[model samples]
Structure formats: structure tokens, C-alpha cells
Target: MKQKRRVRVMVAKPGLDGHDRGARIIARAYRDAGFEVVYTGLHQTPEEIVEAAIQEDVDMIGLSSLAGAHKYLFLAVVELLREKAADDIVVCGGGIIPDDDIKRLKESGVKEVFTPGTPLDDIVKWVKHNITPRQD
Candidate 1:
């Protein structure tokens, strides 16, 4: 029997957000949940995040931003992925984002958004239910 490929995900801190505790936690949670995780450290640009995601061949990207630039930064990553024909990679975000902005982010192509205090297990379950490893 052929074994299933593990889902590979990149956890990124986009923009000038210096806060990374949450990102780190999520990365560890993902790793512990049996997903291959690549973490891009703080102060990453959208371009850099997308580049690393593609290079690492991640099936999903989990972006964290506490700097209030989610509107611009998150959308930029989605757009770049489309421009590069890599939109198959799922994109999601979490941070101090407002509920209003969450609606916008979802409408703009982000698959999901997790706010503060969200359970780590819930996040893990969401990934397991929503994302599959890329076949290629």
C-alpha cells in the first residue's frame, strides 16, 4: 500500500510585525500534529513569504500579523501566488485582526483566519480537514 504524503505548511510572519510568539506556537502545534512545517522568522515581506512557500513546496501558508497591516500584506501574498500561478497553495492568517477585516480577508481568497485565544487543536483539525498534501 502507498503511504499518504504529509501535508507541508509554511508559517510566516508577514510585514513589520515583531510579535512572533503565536506564530511559533502554531508552528510547533503543526509539527506535533504530523505536518511538515517551515517557519519564516519575523519581519518578512509578502514577496519573501510567497517565494519561500513556493521554494519549500508547501501545501498551505499560515500568516500571522499583529501589526495591523493584514489588509495589505495578506492580500499581497494571495495576489502574488495567483500571479505566479501558485494559488493552489492554501492561504490563511491569524493575528490581532478585526472581525470586519476577517470578512474581507476571506472574500479576497484567504481560506481561513484564526484569531487570538483560538484552540490549537481546532487549528490542527482545520488543517487536517481542509488541506491535503500536494500530489506533485
Candidate 2:
């Protein structure tokens, strides 16, 4: 029997965002793609997201933030990831993000940011294609 490759991911809903249908969809997609995913329900703080990632030892952190607070949430998460020295985890997701904001977020340690309407296969491919072991 072939051994299954393990790829743990944390799908989190950060900040004051309450809507979660999208986050749930992405979680199911990742699971169907054979990844072990940890879903952090709505209202997660940046600290909670990072702590969950570290504790769960996830390979990626997928956030669904449509509350227009991605700037604050993403920046805090990035800073905490750096503080915890777990910046290797690939962070990616989609939402109602503006085009220019997407570029800014990438500079702050987000590996990839998907815009609305991105195919599920594309997300799975992105994780499989870019997720790598931590350099530490």
C-alpha cells in the first residue's frame, strides 16, 4: 500500500468576520484533496490562528476574511508568525480583496492570495505546488 503524504493545513476565519460558508467550502476541498485540515471557526484572532498552526503543526494557514479587515489581521498574523519563527508555513486564501491590496499583503508574508472565483483545483494546486518544509 502506498503511504499517504501528510499535508496539514489550518483554515481560519480571523477578526470580526462572521460569515463562514466560504471557509467551510475551502476546508472540505482541502480535505477531499487528501490534506489534514484544521478549521478555526469564525472570530479567530491572529494569535489564535498562529498558535493553532504551531500546535497542530499545519503545513499551511488558509484564512477566509471578507470583513475588510485583512490588512490588520494579515499583518498581525505575519508578525506573530515571524516572532514564533514559523514563517515557513504557506499562507493563502481568497475573498473580496482589492487588487492593489493583494500585492501589499503578499509583501507582508502571505505566500498567495486568491481573488474571488478562483477554482478549487487552483487552490489545491497552489498548496501542493508551493508548500515546502521549514528552513529551520
C-alpha local distance difference test of each model: 0.96, 0.86
Residue 72, model 2: lDDT of: 84
Instruction: Name the lDDT value of residue 74 in candidate 1.
Output: 95
lDDT of 1 by residue, 51-72 (tens): 9999999999999999899999
Off by more than 4 A, model 1: none
Candidate 2: tens digits of C-alpha lDDT, residues 11-86: 9999998989999999999899888889989899999999999999888899888989998898788889989998
Worst lDDT run of 10 residues, candidate 1, spans 127-136
The segments of candidate 2 whose C-alpha lies over 4 angstroms from its true place after superposition are: 1-4, 133-136
Error of 1 at 99 (Å): 0.8
Model 2 Cα displacement at 50 (Å)? Answer: 0.7
The clash count for each model shown is 0, 0
